[model samples]
Target: MTESPASKPVPAREIISWAFYDFANSGYTTVVLTTIYSAYFVGVVAAELDSGEPGSATLLWTLAIAAANFIVLISGPIVGAIADFRASKKAFLFASSVACVAATALLSTVGPENVAFAVLLLTISSVAFTSGENLIAAFLPEIASNKNMGRISGYGWSLGYFGGLLTLGCCLAYINYATGRGLDATHYVPVCLLITAIVFAVTATPTFVWLRERATPQKLPPRKGYISAGFGHVLTTLSHARQLPDLFRFLLCIVLFQAGVATVVVTAAIFAQDVMQFDSQQLIILIMVVNLTAAVGAFLFGFAQDRFGSVNSLVAALLIWILAIAVALQASSEADIWITGNMIGLAMGATQAGGRALIGQLTPVSHNGEIFGLWGLANRTAAILGPISYGVINRLSGGDHQLSLISTLVFFVVGLLVLLTVKEQRGHAAAARAN
Candidate 1:
């Protein structure tokens, strides 16, 4: 098979800078969505809204997350199409990055009395974060050869885990020290969020300085329909995807399992809080440990992706995820929960890094921006379904988390079955020819 243009290598420094974006974004993901602020939102902000029902805050938090995902799902494609056509990925990335950092920092001011503000800021921050994600991923095709895609993607994910681990470590230490000195965690949680914003800004700077857009700008069609051109890009891809069977098949699998992944990620902290009775300090510690394992998993699976093939690596990771969820179902104690958390880390890193590398390998270099936009769309759809399903189930079951955990297994199992039919090498060849 002939190499796609994306398989051409850029500067090593550019690759490092690109990877650092993952570090930056993970600060928000680990702190706000996964560990501290999510729990803070449910336990502190949304709790005051309904004193009699603990589940109310959890439901609201999930719904807010679902709303943000829906917004991203609707907009990711058009924004991606525009970036591709304009050859302005960095410009859009910078805009989204600023919005996320600013919103995260501003979130420091919101407390229990300001539920609506919390929702508004979260929706904005999540959307901004997602936008940045799509833009950065669009850079992958420009930076690494298909042969190294797995390693590069894996490295980025590993660094993200380190970012998460480092951020969580600091938060855990401060919360421990603060609570020991008689300061309430509620007072300190906002400060932790501010630190996350700073970390995000600082770590993400390298990408702005070093990475360059490689795609030549494509002018929109003359006049009239130009405004809606972005919408047409993804639609055209969807209509013609069967011609690139592997890419299409992989995306379908992503939508299936990634929804499960999204649910597991967003809920892990709150699940610990609501079910396992973990305080902020304990939750941070748990997440830190998970990040440590996740980093290792990303590193190992990335290599495995290159050697064993991305599909095999991803399938193995999904099986681990299935087992992790099963463990979570039986988690009735801290040790049991710890087991679940560690397993999640292992599977999380492997699956995500593998999936990303697989997509990079399968896509034509010219279509990176638009194709990954579809990737983001699939991700956001999962984002919508996973959290909403969890929230609805929680509401229906009176917050029975075990049942919610059980629901995620269907995604992994089904995704794996679908993925079995995909031929990665054939897919890459098809993409190269299409381009």
Candidate 2:
């Protein structure tokens, strides 16, 4: 009898450490990027800007996001190639994570009137966060065996959601306590940002200590023009993409679908403040609920992927996203916010975890960094469009957030159609062979 791939076990400690990086970083995604800092930027920092400017705040925010995406688009492939060549994946991960932590901690000092400071800090932090995410993703192949990759990826995302959930809960409690005593809850934003940095730094420590890189570190050629090297890598990856049809298809799906996901993250705080009239405490609660629910969804979907298939799980997650967006568009009250938030939680975890698993199934270990770099570019560059769409629609419609949210559905539907054409099982088989 042949031993099944599913019967093999990965090192438990390494997997845990790798997943803990997600746990640590999720706090930044939750507190800074998604809820508190975004709201602070738009409502406080940007609000203080000169008056009579047409959509100036939204435009600045959009540009910041675009700049971050542009950096990722240019640098992701080079970083991936370097990771592969040097086999210094862990070192890369540590450096990027520390950058993120430092950037986030620096955000603590940006005051309400400090729009320039806020923009600079947030942009740097966003770049670091996304870059670190790409590095962390390269670790999956090291920790999980092929058969259990989907479940393991899901577990990591689930744990991340839980971490976000807990942090948001703490933030909410502090906000409520501050507000009740007639103190300023807004001041706590920086404090929370600092805590997020510390937590990420601490949680990510284990990954650096434990996870072993499979490839040997290579000596990079004497520093040529960095910009030229970056652009060359990007061009090569883009041209090479056509040679891998399945990977191209997967990249396309992720590019479109993830745009919607990224838009939701960037816009949720704005929606709550503008539409639902939520203060900081209420907004924190909403975020906490979503993260909690997403954690559960991640675990469940991970199990489902193992039992059924990653493609199937991903398809179902897209459908859920469509429904969640529709519900969010129609939400008029706090109760509606709760309902939609819960639905988002379920869909968000499945979308991220399942997507990673599917990508893992399609990529060769030797090319993991390069392919995942393309994946990062696709994910982040595609994100640039959604925010632009939302900002444009919001301005045109006089802040009609419902109409703005409808734009997201197009991404999900298109991605779903493209994904439906994919032969997932065959793709996975090919990926295994390439590995």
Give the root-mean-square deviation of each candidate in angstroms.
Answer: 1.9, 3.3
Estimate candidate 1's RMSD in Å: 1.9
| Model 2, runs deviating above 4 Å | 1-9, 49-55, 218-243, 433-435
**Candidate 1 local lDDT, 1-435, one digit each (tens):** 122434465778888899999988998999999889988888778877547764677789889988998898988988888888888889999999999999999999998778999999999999999989888988887778888889999999999999887777777777878888899967789889988998899989999999877877887876635348888887887886878888988998999999899998888888998898997778888889899899999999999998999998998999999998888888879999999889999999998898888988898777888889999998899888888888778877877888877778888889889999999889989987977
TM-score of each: 0.97, 0.92
- Candidate 2 lDDT over 1-435, as tens digits, reads 111234445578878877887888899999887898888777777874425554456557767876787888778778887776667667777777888889889888878767788888888888888988888887676566667888899889999987787677767776777667787745777777877887778777787787666665544456755445545556766675545567778888998899899888988987888788898877887888788889998999998888888888889999998888888877877888888888888999998999888787787666777778888888887778778787777767766778888888888888889888878877866666655
Q: Which candidate comes out best when scored by lDDT?
A: 1
TM-score of candidate 1 against the unseen true structure = 0.97
Best candidate (score: TM-score): 1
